[model samples]
Target: MSAKPSGSETEIVDGGSVRRDHTDRFDLRALYETSQLLSSSLELEFVLNNLLLTAMSKLLSTKGVALLFDPLGSAYRVAASKGIAALPTGTDIVLDGIDTNDPMLEDDVPERLLEHGVKLVFPVAFGHREIGLIGLGPKFTKQPFEERELEFMASLVNMSSAAVHNSLMVEELKLANRDLDGKVQQLNTLFDLSQEFNATVDRKRLVKLLTFALMGQMMVTKHVFMIRSVTGEGDNGSNMHIVTAKGVRKEDLDADTIASMCAQQDMVLFVEDGDSEACDHLREKGFRLVLPIRQKGDTGAVLCLGPKMTGQTYQPDEIEFLYALGNLAFVSLTNSYLVEEQIEKERLEEEMRLAREIQERLQPRELPVMQTIDAASLALPSRHVAGDYFDAVRLDDDRMLYAIADVTGKGVPASLLMS
Candidate 1:
């Protein structure tokens, strides 16, 4: 028998002889380069494809390669492959544990490998987690794999596993960022719409604007505003009047019934799909939401909405938006009422001023310098412009005409007619 080679030498055992030669450093360099390439990229698809291509070109010395990932419960998705005749994209393969000794290999194997002259199957895993498997066809030189080649293939599989793990983490981070961005955009839109609503004072126009703003911002199908009159007789009685409504039939709503129910229940908000008994009747009536419009501790009105245009149920965010919109409507209504009242007060004051002018002219100026038994007369008007008149005129031959008259009211009409 031939003597065994030293530690630093390569030994070949053929027949009954042993030959020792220097080890080839090229294979070691190839392995290091492959590891560097695999570690550099964290993108899942890029890393996976590079790993397969590098292994086939440098480590395994194969003409073709294939990478498969068994998402376990999901499909057996193909990541990358080379050297096969038009390798299927997103192909599923059944793997079996008996088919290969690779630790990352699955229990069900693809049957095509048997017919296609596959030389090796490598399982790639991160710790105990089986990320995927690799398959390689025979080398172009048609040479059998030596022990050294098998060892290098094993190292490549380890590098591939780490790359796959990093890629998956990156993908998960990207998805999370996208979700967060969507939420932030929604919040920004809500804030802007709220600001616009707060600046208006016309009740009818405000209600219409609010409904349209909410629908556009939140992408809802329809919104309705049902404003109940504040002044009405009886506490428990049906006094709810539909002052304004949109996106629904005014005739279809029973305003008195809704008002009475709201008054009895003492509920300010009624979400039709939420867990509340107050919303039961509203839900049956095809309304998806009912938001109360409150002003200074009194429930003055209700704003309702149907389902969203997306046909999805309302989320907590959507409910909050509706509440804000309802509050804005109440503020606008109150402001409009105050403006109307002030205008009416100013109008009445103007009329009183005009009446005073007419009354002052109606009285005789300087009392005609009369000398009928030394008579004199004076008239004084009240703050409300009363129509009290006094007159004295000297007639021919020392005869005098004197008269005093009072009209009922104290305005332009009474003053003009008094003349």
Candidate 2:
């Protein structure tokens, strides 16, 4: 027969089994809510904050902190916190992987967290590596965390770690794309300048265009342009003359300073130490960079620039391109000067030939003969047209007069004066 309970006795019951069923249902609901909240955003900081808040709520803890690992520095930094005032953000700690499942069971929790009253440490792991840690104070109910609750916390972190890592990767890709776009823009600017430089030959206009292009590209306001001073018959010279200047006193760029800069074959920065007096003068004039324009192993020109208006230092690639463009402009200016010289020489030579022809025509082809007495004349010409002349005049009876004269100067002017 089945046993029946007596009125004073209570029937046996499995209270532990009933409690386990209730706890399982509660844990499932909490996990579902945590997943939904964390997966709603791709922003790392937002995800971290939400994760900490959810963990604290589920565990009934008063304090919580999230520390994310920075692989570059090989350390973990506090990324998010709640309810703990003294746990400042961005605090670094070095904690390796642990075999113990519960942080409270570990022998060595970092003192930074221990001193802040952190009682539990949970690893947020992804793909066999720990990416961060979650620390929490004691539960509000003063109840010890069960095995099921710790396991559920680990599952929650695992799900969120993947999302965090993916967000970081996306951010890196965006930065790389921006850098590439900047490079392409620089290349296009250089190509346009090259086309303009090819079509330009006027010295003044060329310098103006070059200056404008450099100022616009580099974002600089102060500049000085120096080109070699060509005199006499040849295109080469060692003297450098400043062609244009702005944002600095022109007199400050003295002769000796320019000469010293023109002697250098490479770009130089005017710093505080180990520089010559000329460089010091440049610094005083607010010039930060000096770039040489070399022709045939000698500096034919130089470009001086002040600090960038954008407050950024010039990169190596930018300096290299400026050097190349400066040299190109120098060559074009030199060619224009040579062409002008040749044109002037040709024009002078043509005028000299015309003057000689007019002088020859003005003289009598043959001297008139006088019957009473014999008269003779001879003419000799020099390589250059000198305004020397000889003429004969006769009066009817038996008298002849011979005259000679020389005019000052040479070529056309002298010939016209003589005439």
Candidate 3:
């Protein structure tokens, strides 16, 4: 069975008796309640506030109190307080060594507290670590804290330390969960956008769809689609050209400037107000980005997206999303252009095959056999039709003449002239 708490008393000098009062019983109950409440609370701020209030109400019975901690700084910072009229969020009290060993002792503590009439202090500890210090002002009942009150306060600190540790773990878990959820949502949106954008073959329509889709999904304020000629024959010095734009002036974009900015085969991003020397021209033109559209080793063009519609600075996650979007867009655009080129190539090949067949029919199948002269002639066509021609004519009295000549070029014109 647990030992019953005795209402012990002691005699002091000056004809005064130091008796354990009813307040001590109340203090024990308050300590138990504080432990129970803290055990259930997983919030760090609630645990701190509850600990401060409980100490003030039970341990010293102070009308006002403040809790300070070593922020590992030059002074003790107030972490929490109660019953104070005005307490700054960050208030420090300097320490002077009255007693070198016990800094929390009343005589060794700050003079500012002594001037303010503070009487008692409790040094909070967890294992070997001194977590903080709690200063209690003069008691509301005008009595000093006895030994029993100090014991109860120490027990409260021990129980509350476990709660503080658990609350910190819970807070960290909450932050990690939020970050994971954000990444998952971004990936899901990117996947859906990629599938939708790649389903079409029309280059112009694909770019427009991708631009509008990204603007709607990514919450961008503006979008610009640029295309570069692989053969590089245009008014712009570089092959980069803007195909479509929204929320920016057409004249503001310069292909040469964008190419120069993204010279080292990397994507460019600008989300904040200021601009570097590499991007100052864009800032002067009130543009935010000149993201490169690249595929393989080739720098095709750029897709410039402006600041987010929310008007807040772009976070790291947003920049990552833009990088991913640019990659996917580059692949899709390259695929569409490649498909178009293949179709054109196949069409030209078919035309060349038909022309070759027509030219073959026009050529002489068999040369006239020459009986007088003991000679034979034959012709063979190369993979592509060429301009070699040979013919034999019968002359008077069985005298035969044969001639062979080569034309200048190959293909239909050469084949026609040879015919």
Candidate 4:
């Protein structure tokens, strides 16, 4: 079967007659039916079943196995088998110390195969490439397989080799498509979550959404969100603190453990199956994931998750979704922080304006505005709002008293003191 000269096509050079490999076939119609049935379907199992049945009927064998080459593993595994209880199906075989890819029979077949009741070990090749092996036990009549029977088996295997290769390719294609669809659906989900996250600007409410998303999507219960202070926290500092948490008590979250992870994962960290000490420590604490939200060039916040309720390892796409979610959280939190800061700045500005006005009122605006001794006065502090006091008092008709004093400090406080 393996790129060897076909037995039926051989010519006898030593004798005047050419002997073709022949079997006691009823007619050409039976061979035609065998060919048509095996070629009818691209289903590997169906093809293997019909092929093995045809072999057993033609050769009267009681045990058989269809071994197909797995290209990825570079080994042969049993695809189908029957009546061979001693041989383990589904386990790959290396042919253990075999020399040739050519078909072997009788004493030439390896001893290990002999132990498994393999009377015939032939390769099924398509064009120039051998794709599989056919192993058969001794015939039920206890007779050894004849050369003619082996020749017929080879023809049947060759006819089905093309179908077998096609079926394997189709199965691999189906798996690849399924994986792609899963990733695309995951992306669509992340896109929708991003929209929701952007619309919410309140940090507390945004955190709640993030928490719910993780729990609902990942089926996680024990989790914490450690948000680094936007104004002060950084990879070099301990300003990161748990802003929201569930299941885990506050006391159990060690500060050093949290800070160490923050420093290590400056951009992002998915803690599943990592060998680093920080990752190991986190895993030991029952936390399986840590995602740090990037703000500027540092870690702005982090979300740590415990073991999933489903108890499954995180896939690549799920980890990617977490990265997307973290970025959305970063933007929302930063916007909320900026809005609060601006509001506080405006409030302080308003208070300063009011204090400055009070200081102006305390000054002698017109210096009595009277014709008593042609008196004149002016007062101006060296700063925007300062503590300074000066006044002139007219008594009766001819007496007058002028007073001046300086108060401590500046800005709003000093202006209030001057009054």
Candidate 5:
């Protein structure tokens, strides 16, 4: 069961009986009801809507608007409104002198609000700072606001400010949570790719694996991957080469573009919307960001990412993941190069061993056992396959001919040339 609310009260003062006035008692009930309704929910829009409606009803006004100050943006935005020209919620109004936290009449209101038929402005405040404004138009009766009415509106704003602040806090927290969820997803993808990178040794296949990972997880549609040469060729300075391309072509990206975009190898570059020639050129190519990979204090590789299919800019952690992926791919490719080099070195060493053996055989064995003047000779190869040879032949009746030679080079070529 519910009992009807009463506005009657009694007080014994000065040894006499006195009764509380109905208007004062009624105002108390209204304030209590307004506070209860405002506190019922933390939804910002709901709270602001109810607040605007209550202010309109109390003032008997035809138009009203709820404006919340955005400290970060340094402006006020329309949170809710009634009977006014349609200004969408969150539309910014950059009015100055609004932070005075004082009630404003028609003459005191800004010209902008005056155009919207706002006749009164009440500041919504908590502690020392005013967070918002409640603007009311003229009453339906066409009469000016009374002194008590102004007082009541101030009281209503004071009561509702706490609820609005709480709602704003909750909304900000939800946004933060959303950003964190994205970060976790990206890191998990990186973890899986790291394992795959370890197993991949072929450069072409490694690049394919990385490209697929970006397309699947990051919603990347257009991308290019370029890696600088590690061999240190002085004549060419060893510029980076395009290893993979999706929507972009190898010829479209010149050497200067890659070098300029990757100037800051330690950090990612976010393409800003601008009129500069470089920026316009990148935008024309559909590239949105550039991620550089560092090796020995130099730009070793770069991953040029185009816009996502969803048209969302890359988040901070997403950029971090791409940079890490580029580095991982580079490490795997470097290892592949080293493995191939080792195999080649071993093959050449085996060829050298065979050449040395042949060279020894071709060398004069025992020098034909010369019996002239007790002649003797020995030819032992050093650690290398040198082009060394020695021989002596008797040229008819005590005339002797001898030949000895050592090639300038070593290894298989020298041994073959000497033979």
Candidate 6:
């Protein structure tokens, strides 16, 4: 079937000319179907591809392309292409003076488009802004476009622009929702870790929980944990001591290396290509991130780990979460140490009280009476048991000896000696 020129009205002909109402009916029906198809989906790619295909088939063009405007940036890229093999999708091209006012012919189109073999350019526009462009090659008839054809094409593009803009907005909203979900999950993980840590007093158990939380949340592969002191012993003037480690070679991060890390007082990333020797050294030791576990503004511990198991770099937000967990670990451990010290002090005080009682019992309650001599004894007990002893002895009828001795040291040992 072909449609040819018939005065001011178009006609449909099979073997002979048809009336103008039939052709009008056909075009009206086609436009209705095209509107239905374009409004069917919110998927940007599907809508653009279908729109371009419909336009090319209607116009009898061999090639067509759709370029979408990037709402977040100042660039336009090819979104859909047909019957053109050399053009690359996502390639950006700039077209100046191509306003959203109306559809443009090849002469009115930008000169830059000639290189892409585009003959017709339609601005898919809505609300005074162009959201996309539809480019079409020459029609198969190789004839100039009629006024009615341009008007129809303009209507098609104008109607589809709103749908395209809505689809792009929907995609942007989905991406924002996904990003918000990730942040929420990260916060939940940190909160859970903090609760578990606050309940924990044992250093080993705390480290184990930290490792599990870190690996579960951040997908860590290799890590080591260090504290300022261990069992209050073997500090040997060093500030940091390694408590536990995994996947680390010996001589890589010793007490000296940890001291250097603590000196920074902030999180550090070891870059393999860094200009600093210290960072390069850390990188060579398989450490990608080092964090200080601070308590009361002092670095009480350190945490070091390699790259994520998935080989992704640690993001700033993830590192901040690690910092928070690290500080929580330090505070928990410090509280445990304080509680242990308090208990030890209380035990020592109780022992001193018992020792004082025993020493009092060992001393004479009253001095013996002497018929010919007057004698007095004074005993003073130290805050800790001092173990002082005194005795009045009668040797024969006329001889009396007074003896007194103070023992060395204090507490239970001195109290036992006095007894």
Candidate with top TM-score is 5
TM-score of every candidate relative to the true structure: 0.49, 0.56, 0.64, 0.69, 0.78, 0.65
Query: In candidate 4, which residue ranges exceed 4 Å CA deviation?
Result: 1-39, 42-157, 233-237, 265-272, 295-297, 364-405, 412-419
Per model, how many backbone clashes are there? 9, 0, 0, 0, 0, 0
lDDT of 5: 0.77
Q: Candidate 5: misplaced stretches above 4 Å? A: 1-26, 83-86, 110-119, 128-130, 138-140, 232-238, 264-266, 273-277, 350-361, 364-386, 390-403, 408-413
lDDT of 2 by residue, 1-419 (tens): 12335443434446433211234323566677777777777777888888898778767788999987777887888888888888678877776554334455334566667778787887776776656788888789888777776776777777777776675566668878876786677678777777777787777787777778678777777888778777522122336666677786666676666765666544555444327776776777777888887667766788888888887887776787777777777777777777888888899888778867777777766766888778676555563466778887776567777788888776556766888
CA lDDT scores, all candidates in order: 0.64, 0.72, 0.66, 0.73, 0.77, 0.75
**Candidates 2 and 5 compared by lDDT, better number:** 5
In model 2, which range of ten residues has the least summed lDDT? 16-25
lDDT of 2: 0.72
**lDDT per residue, candidate 3, 1-419, as tens digits?**
12234554222334353434455444556667778998888987788788777877665555444454454674666666675545444677766543322325356556776665556666655666555566667667766667777676667777787776677568769989998999999899788878876788787777776776668777778866666665665324556555666887666656655565446345556624444565666565555766676666666666666777787666778778777877777777768878999999899889878866766665456655656556666666664566877766767656766778889987667776877
lDDT score, candidate 6: 0.75
Go through the candidates in order and give the C-alpha RMSD of each one to the true structure.
11.4, 9.0, 7.7, 7.4, 6.7, 6.7
Candidate 1 per-residue lDDT, tens place, 1-419, comes to 45565776777888967777545433676667777887898887788777777767654455444555556544345567676655565666665444334522212335656454556777777876666667777767677666666677787787567778888778879978876786686567667756665666666666667767767666666665655554564222445655454556666656443753355333334454356554665665566766666656666766767777788877665676667666666666656766877888899988777767766776777665545466566666655676678887778657778888989987556666777
Off by over 4 Å in 6: 1-38, 48-159, 230-237, 249-251, 265-274, 347-383, 386-400, 406-419
Instruction: For residues 1-419, write the lDDT of model 5, one tens digit per residue.
Output: 22333535333344454444335522867988988998999898898999898888877889899998888888889989888866667689988865456899989998788988999998887787667888999999898988888888888888888988888778889889988887787777778888888877888788889888789778998998777765653112336767788988777776556555556533667667444565566777888887778877878777888989998878777777888888888788778778888988899888778877776777556654445656677766665587677777877666677888888876557666888
> Which candidate has the highest lDDT of all?
5
Q: Please list all clashing residue pairs in model 4, or write none if there are none.
A: none
Question: Sort by TM-score, best first: what order?
Answer: 5, 4, 6, 3, 2, 1
| Superposition error at 338 for model 6 (Å) | 2.9
Ranking by lDDT: 5, 6, 4, 2, 3, 1
